[model samples]
Target: MASKLAHPLLHALRAGGPAFGAWLTLPGALSARTAAAASPHLAWLVVDCEHGMTALHPGAGESIAAVAALGPRAPSTIVRIPATGACADGSAGWQIKYALDQGARGVLVPMVSTGAQAKSVVAAARFPPQGVRGFGSPFTQHAWGADVTPGEYLAHANDAVLVLVQIETRDGVANLDEILAVDGLDGVFIGPYDLSLALGLPPPSPDPHPEAETVIQTILAKAHAAGKKWSVPLRLSFRSLPRPNPVTNCRDLLHRGTQAAKRAKEGFDMVNVTSDSGAMSDGIAR
Candidate 1:
């Protein structure tokens, strides 16, 4: 039997296929309309606090709250917390835990610079022996249901939680091997804009400088060797709207998929939707 796209992108990465996707911001407070917009494409949605989307409020970030609100609507939720003192203090990490407790499948730590940061992020995603995330559901994450069990949730989470570390700096690229060597990391998401800036190039440069690009490919190769996903974030933010194009959302992968298919005619796996945010209906942005 043909294997189904379980955990969609995760399954693709594990099967040595292209793992490409994009981001979505949890706008201020979430509404069902916002949830509906982001429920469509891509294997997962990265609820931004780090970059991509601008912050809508102060105190707690928008990503966590948005996930808490719309998680059930989306197939998989990945919250991106700021990589500042907030996350470094571990408070933001707990917010990530709370988002999971609310139903997020994973967390995306942005501007990840070292293996230590990766370790901390992984630790926060897990419960006890694996790490130290507290258990509290039966809330919106569990839909306030009586049927969800703590024990069951914990056990499943131990194996199912995915941690994606953002790689977007000169140092991050330089230490790519050691960072990928971190035991609990499930994957790395290349943050193209910051990476371009770090390499002393323009902010929106899609074609990475040869050496920098080589570093990125190396990370993907290493991640594949390590049995981990290499998630590339394809956000077409600067472009004007009418704002929904499948090609723009998964740019690099679209190109690679085309070339790969031409070279070998091998098939590729895909998630149910293309990109998970900005879905509109009745001639309005959702």
Candidate 2:
């Protein structure tokens, strides 16, 4: 097998330490650049095309470039494509290909409820004979942060790109074991809010409800047992708060940061600090 290219996010996960990241929801490079420069501790930046303003075509690619251009300190860019699964027509496969071709180091697929769905995600993100992804993007090398030729990129991309699936539904929770059993799936990201809704409970509480907490714990345990990285989105409230209150602003930032740290200490492999919209809104308000 050709040596897979180095990816900072994967390296951090393999290093046995928690990898922190930010979520990008706004559709521009400025927010991405600013958020990526906020803390060198960031290992990845998830461009949220699923629920955010970013689109797969040009928006995701632009934001990815902005984040990846931060040089060595740049966190690996992962595009969360706005699709649920690989439909019969193979729409998910094409979306995954576009995101990868645009230079995303990884792909975050949401609403994966079965092992079969995960298998499709993995296949879409990787190259053959391990997958069905077609190669031919001339600009892909730049997103990878390498200077290799197209052939070199293709030779190792199967292993180089990370494929993460979201476990956010009751069906997903029930099929957790099977999903984790899928080969080539690098990690699982838990969508707490969606998971809560899926469980027929009130939306995300200030703290997760007992039922949600139980589900979260189960997912974390199973992921660790399977030797796969698990991540959670930790939304910060600073953006939602009324600004002009320096003390309150500081307190909120500190509180959110602490919560993220606590999650990491509790064994989450990755934690999202904040999103582009959150940071930008907070910055503008300040």
Candidate 3:
């Protein structure tokens, strides 16, 4: 019942319940569809353009549509644009445009270190008066399955499109207060492994270093105190994992069930299916 007016992710967030998400790193529509269908608990799916095999332009767009075709209750598709903090300016605007115009429910901007950068992301993802994002996608309105006319989609999109910034850098931690104060931001998604590395600690091995865990909790508290949603994952990355037997790889979600429960207990807004595409790949069972 999330995003009753539009996207399910928004609906889930508004419902004040912890939404589960699938981490999509692989490309192709079939893969996305499979993932969306794997778990009824899946409230959203993130098309990982940042580090995944999925390309931004056609790939992410196709994935968005693939999941949308599953109907209104199907998981909402969000795009994690592949760019670093350096492109906080208008350079990232076009990428944001592509993702939203393709009918994505949300956009996750990576490595946002300053409030100005977070504002830039928010502005780029929204329409005018609130943002500089342009309109004209005939397909976008259909993606939400409401049969909303262009006018309806345009009117609600500014509020419906969730904009989140990753707080993973040293400067991001230092400026967390300022970033949280920025208007138009929907939430903050913590990148724990990167946060560890940024803070001169090792990447989390299933869990963050003790010090990094402290920081993660601090971030959770800060996000809640600021009245913004906090999103994170059980595992930070799967890029380092070897290409193992597909069946073995697919059991990650089951393996992480305990951590998932722990995350839910900690008041995270949403937690990932697994650290990688493996959890949902090849129609893996939840």
Candidate 4:
């Protein structure tokens, strides 16, 4: 039987190609549909609930449904949940449960600062025997975009779902080696803005301070050495491109295409192109 849980983004990462994607910050299915249909090349789409308008329950579910509606052609949907520290009474676990239940292909937890915290994120995302995720969501199959039985979904979810933790603080950088050592962690994502702040530099610098660059390089090298996938957000410029015009459309396409190529060349396993909010702002400005 065909593997019902196979994900294109997972395949891309395994094949060692950069999985390019866009961030969904808007809170609706229309926005998701538009973004997913914009490019067939997108390997995944991150439904940003942490900083975006997508709420945990209905909004996230709607967005996931919209994207997954594309079926095989849809970019894999991964949701970035709000911050959680360590185990913290399993609040993070509950969030993971809700996201997975709603049919997110993966979950990204932000602000993790230690190996213990990384382990907790993994436990919350995986099922028992490997971790502690419970399986009782009747609607999860819909989000998976496959016609698998519930038993099959449960059996394969542990390996199918991607579990990523953000390394964005001084403590997280200090414990990078230990965090990478945690089992069941699929990858680590760097929040360059917060990382800059943690490094005592200005937040959101176009050019990172030399010290912050060292930390970023260290995380990248260590993740590779541990055979784990690592990612960093790279926001591309949409300015100077007129919106709704063919000229602008060509420019946007070319710009994103170039950025995706550069990210692949840089050896990033996954890359988020830009956020929905950012796109909207850029359009309005244009």
Candidate 5:
């Protein structure tokens, strides 16, 4: 059934290839469209609403629309809403609702550290009977496609929309089993940067401490064991930190590509290859 959906990510996974994606942070319809059409290997694109310049309300919607405009070739849009880490609380409900309401194919909640927290995020992304998401967005069906009516979308959305949570804190890793047990959660996305910081280490400077790497592997194994997918963005976190040499940016992309391939072979379901700004930075530095 997932294969029948007009979702490129599903097609990519089915074809056993090009499961990687780019993260969008620049904020604009043009930026979103460019990233979506950037590569055929891109199976997904995350519209960063948390720390990115894109506003959660109008900006995320526009970006999702931009990707959807690509029709069949568009990578699936997954919005990372604001609220860095919701720990054991359910405070991210409204934010999840806003993103999903805007027609995002999925929602990635950051810093989820507990089973209860995971359940709440799932609830907010799903409709009642299974969860508590409201569905009155008239424009949402348009993003799905011209043939999809509101009724069809509402009927099939619960299955099509993915709800993934970022497991990047000590508590999240410790409670991994419980969080993975949450129903309606499609997968877990690992945030190497925050996970390192939460575990008493610096963010990955192209890679994590040996101990952090061990933990990441453990999480991946545990998620797969529980019959859930594991995902991750570029491992060279440090979005705000500077580099030793701008020239290293080119090598970094190569390193990232290598890492992404290794993980994908290791059973990682989704791996983000780069970002809008990351590519631009590498190009400018070269």
Candidate 6:
């Protein structure tokens, strides 16, 4: 399938407003419920390709395929590529290129701690002199058709690919200025869990740690000041269902959303909800 070319991330950037999104770490790739969680109104989709163990060895092709299938069906597809030396072995670059060429709207490089690391991520996602990324479109480029040209492919590949960096360690936050200064960095995503480890503190509610939130707000403020977009992950557990099997989990989420809406109707304003999974769920109001 010659995937549609509009990048949701670009739209998000253009909107220049707070963007809410979710992370999928459950078994299997993006399930129907996971995909359903994505709202076009939301800015992006961070497919936790690295830390989220939905797949033992996350395959770039499969990840791209799954996300692409949701195009126009969901928000932008931002695959969180492994941010380790293992990916530095050319295989990771291939994965980045394949995902992009296969219609992934963007790539999120996780655990980035330095300017060089951020640049390396850019290199993996781009092609030629600009970066070292390889090229292939497969079905995504043409949306499964064969009309897409090399020129068009290269242009779309360059113009629309979103590059995100995850700042998870204290080192990354301390060196935030240099990392954000790196050209072509699309955004700085915060990983609260690892960040806590970096801060020598327990995980969320990362409250009571004004220092950590300060660092996060600093990153966010700097990113905004630098004219960069910011993306955050939200994790939600619905109350409708007590247990979180795939089926009940979704129902519970809907039930909770419904209740929240009902509360709003009753004149109580409830904008966000926090749940387990330790991942950030934006608690998107349906």
Better of 2 and 6 by lDDT: 2
Question: Which ranges of candidate 4 are over 4 A from the true structure?
Answer: 236-260
Q: Any runs in candidate 1 off by more than 4 Å, and if so which?
A: 1-20, 26-41, 52-74, 85-92, 140-147, 237-286
Worst 10 residues of 1 by lDDT: 265-274
Question: After superposition, which runs of candidate 5 have C-alpha atoms over 4 Å from their true positions?
Answer: 1-5, 14-18, 87-90, 235-246
Instruction: Give lDDT per model, in order.
Output: 0.55, 0.83, 0.83, 0.81, 0.83, 0.58
Tell me the number of clashing residue pairs for each predicted model: 7, 0, 3, 0, 0, 14
- Cα TM-score per model: 0.69, 0.91, 0.91, 0.89, 0.93, 0.72
Please give, for residues 1-286, the per-residue lDDT of candidate 2 as tens digits.
Answer: 2333537787888789699998888888887888888887889899999998888898899988887777755888999999984342466888899999998889999998888889888988888888899988888877665566787788778877899999988889999999999899999998877888899986553456788988998899999999899999986555444444666666666777888889999999999988777665556656
Give the per-residue lDDT of model 6 (tens digit) for 116-143: 7777778887777778876654455652
Report the Cα lDDT for residue 60, model 6.
44
Highest TM-score: which candidate? 5
Q: Write the per-residue lDDT of candidate 3 for residues 184-246, one digit (tens) a residue.
A: 998999888889999999887666799998988999999999999999866633334565445
Poorest stretch of ten by lDDT in candidate 6: 267-276
- Runs in model 3 lying further than 4 Å from the true structure: 1-5, 236-255, 280-286
TM-score of 2: 0.91
The alpha-carbon deviation from the true structure for residue 143 of candidate 5, after best TM-score superposition, in angstroms, is 0.7
Q: Could you tell me the TM-score of candidate 5? A: 0.93
**Collision count of model 1:** 7
> Scored by Cα lDDT, where does model 5 land?
0.83
